[model samples]
Target chain A: MSTSQGLRAWLLTEEPTSRRQARMAAWYKGWLTLRSNTLAMLGLMVLVVLLLAAIFAPLLATHDPFAQDLGQRLLAPGEGGHLLGTDSLGRDIYSRLLYGARISIYIVALVVMVAPVVGLIVGTVAGYAGGWIDVLLMRMTDIFLAFPRLILALAFVAALGAGIENAVLAISLTAWPPYARIARAETLTIRNSDYIHAIRLQGAGPLRIVTQHIWPLCISSLVIRVTLDMAGIILTAAGLGFLGLGAQPPSPEWGAMISEGRKYILDSWWVATIPGIAIFSISLAFNLLGDGLRDVLDPKEGQS
Target chain B: MSAIDIRNLTVWFGHGADRADAVRDVSFEVADGESFGLVGESGSGKSTILRAIAGLVPTWSGQMTVAGETLGPKRSKSFYRKVQMVFQDPYASLHPRHTVDRVLSEAMQLHGVRDIDTRIGRLLDDVGLGPGFRFRYPHQLSGGQRQRVAIARALACDPAIVLLDEPTSALDVSVQAEILNLLTDLRQEHKLTYVMVSHDLGVVGHLCERIGVMQEGRFVEVLSVEAMRRQQAEAPYTRHLLESSINSIR
Candidate 1:
């Protein structure tokens, strides 16, 4: 038979009754291939633990995070009821770490959520629109990127005046440009895709094409980029708090605790060490999760 | 009345030192439901003419009317609903991330098609794909299957006209014939007008009612398949091309 005839026959042929089950079996086999990646499994585990810790912190911690006892100040780890020892202010270190996690996790989640939404809107419009709109939006993004992110964020914080809300606003504004750039690049690529053109040819408007075709395809990359950005936001928020520009004292911010503990580092290593470890662990968890998600979510990567 | 009418169409790209006219002062007419083929070598502007008609290449200056509606500088959604395009590379034409169902449903949804699942299922079956294949992504299918899916996508809006840009050039010859037959069947079934651009004369002869040979942005010769086969084309360029194709077959 000729090649076309063979293809027609193959396309037309009805499979046996068990073929559907076999296809499902093959799909599961592919899923199992992904599940077998050791690093991804470990990353997922770490992410779940950190998420649970952040979610159930109040129930998990023994003491009120903000409550203080002057007599308990500087008590070392394992001394009486001060399990992780007391900070310089005699605040319970363990409770503060738990509450500090609340701040760090909240900032990361909020920044990640808000930044990508802004980015998706800006990037999809700019990239898919192309021509003058693309040029104007991209140049604006370039201007944002030209300034060092931290300094730009610092200026925004200064303008807004220092506080948790201002710090979040500052970070979010600075952070969105990266997601915009990623979304724009991905949008540019997706706009040229046949499915998008096909939709356009089918009398779909620009908004429909972008929302239905371009957005869904670019979402995996966006999700991965947002996951990675979560780590950076956490670190940046902590840094701002450390510099006393965010989350004022006694709010149990990890960076504030570390900053307050710095002067007595030699006398009470536990104060800085506990929150520092928390920051390190949470950031590491996000980084690992982002990497695993990048691998798994990419259809091309997963296939291989 | 003609289903498509074009007069004095010229399409240019870039400006100043880099300016190039991709399609220049080309004109053609296709009677309603007629299968018209545009044939040429690469860079011969056959594809550009189709693009201009389909409203893809908006930088062209032209008088193009499809189904009696005057073509405009920018395409409208309603214009697209009437005329659609199928590109050469099936691989690049379909989004790999979407399942066959999503790919097919988008156009229907855009057109506010009611009872989308029934339409999609019927379309899949019409394109010779089983119901089981509807949920599979493009990458899961082979080249010919993807091309069939592309065809189904073009047909989804129930377009009266389709601009086929070398629709089978990327496929194996045998698969090309299948697509040609599928296109032929679809045109007859829907009474659709086709403006297909192709370099392969054999495939065009097999499918199109009339063929216009394009060269250097102009229609050098327009002939029926019977005229082409009977006269054996005495034009030097056409003769040369025929000779080369015959030699290749030998």
Candidate 2:
């Protein structure tokens, strides 16, 4: 009884100074909570470094990413003016690393941005509507999942032909199924929740229940999934580039640089090594960041 | 006139091999400004009756009319506007991600309410939550506070009939009393009609003017609090329930 009185007193206490003050408090709390995760902070630092490198590639690189000097071809690190040596086409490995960051960063940003919106819409509709709609939509998602991811992406790229746009499309198509599956599961869990039922009872429509109530609650998991998928997307783009299906020759994509320099592995190890390291570092960073985010955003973990 | 009227309602779930009827041959009426209680154990279709009325459980065939309009295959906005529901778990009934403001505002927005902020403010105040709580998320509030917010959200559209499915069952005993008091106060203040489904006869006795005892998807007896206290149960099933509860408590 005393506990209940104390709770009531707390609830009825004087209001916050203002809405802005309340918002600032919430923001500060979130930031403080997020900052506690060391691994997430490290991942964030790596992401920032990659993003900075991608944004200022022109300023950071002395030699042009695309320019080739045939005489300098197959040069090892510390040879002539090439810092990280030269690819098979004689493009500077340092400059290509900088430029390749642009492709990786762009693909990650675009895929994460596009896939979630589509998946959230489709999954929310299917899960919230239930019955025949749910059955039809889930079956469609299953069909997309039936094919192995890389093969399906390869098939899509094959159909759309090679280019950045086709690559983005392939990744987008392959990526949304996971989001759809996750969002569907989330919606299924939340749809039966009391708040959702309460919202429905208030005469709020199906769309409102999904967009306002369901989506916001599920967004944290969706965000973590998107971040994890970033690593896979970068890897897939590189794989395609290796197969000569992404970023045509001399374009200086990381995988293309590796493919072009693979023959010189014994002598000019730096040619493929630098770009390979960049890919590994960036993908690893995103995975770690995603894991950290999952820990932080989870309510059970957040409270502790 | 009846605020909510239902006749011969039946609800079924699953299909073919898994199919089974969950609610069968149920009928009741709640008069305007009256509180009617439906008491039943788990799986007795009490909650399903509420869901059927709310249009969440659409697999049911029933004659359900709220505010004199006949309910149909698709739920109309008007039907929702008049009849709303408060669910079992306060913890789950309010979306954890939404602020109390957004939770209330979204409902008003869907109903195309004008002057949303004022309406929301008034609702928050009506539910006894201070203005500060309006901006706080569900996690920030206590269970009772959250339930209050849930009640406020329900009252946003000035719904005439509110279907309450075990609203206080999730709270502590003392907290349950407080919520029950709040609910009773709100019902009286709004002149609202209530169709509360609960297993607690004491709660029903405290709040409801009429009580219906359900078993196996059917009402075994519908009686007033006076009838219940007098131990004047008409049906064998209601007598068994009353006897069992009495025996357990003793």
Highest DockQ against the true fold, candidate: 2
Cα lDDT tens digits, model 2, A95-182, are 8888888988777778877888888888889988898999999898888767676686678777878877777777787778788989
Clashing pairs in 2: A194-B93, A195-B92, A195-B93
lDDT by residue for model 2 over B1-250, one digit each (tens)? 9888899999999988997888889998888899999998999989999888888887988698888889897788888788888878887777666667777888898778899988877888888887878787677788888888888878888888898989899899998999999999998899999999999888898899899999888888899889888889999888888888778779
> Quality of candidate 2's docking, in CAPRI categories?
medium
lDDT string for model 1 (A1-304, tens) is 6997864444433331233443443355445554777666676677677677778988988788888888889889878687799987788888788777778877877787787888888899999999999999989888866777668667877788888888888788877888788889888877866666666677777887788777876777888888777777888888989999889987999999999999999978988998899888777777777777776667545352
Error of 2 at B155 (Å): 1.0
DockQ each: 0.44, 0.53
Judged by DockQ cut-offs, is candidate 1 incorrect, acceptable, medium or high? Answer: acceptable
lDDT of each: 0.80, 0.82
Instruction: Give the per-residue Cα lDDT of candidate 2 at A279.
Output: 86
Q: B131 in model 2: Cα distance from truth in Å?
A: 0.9
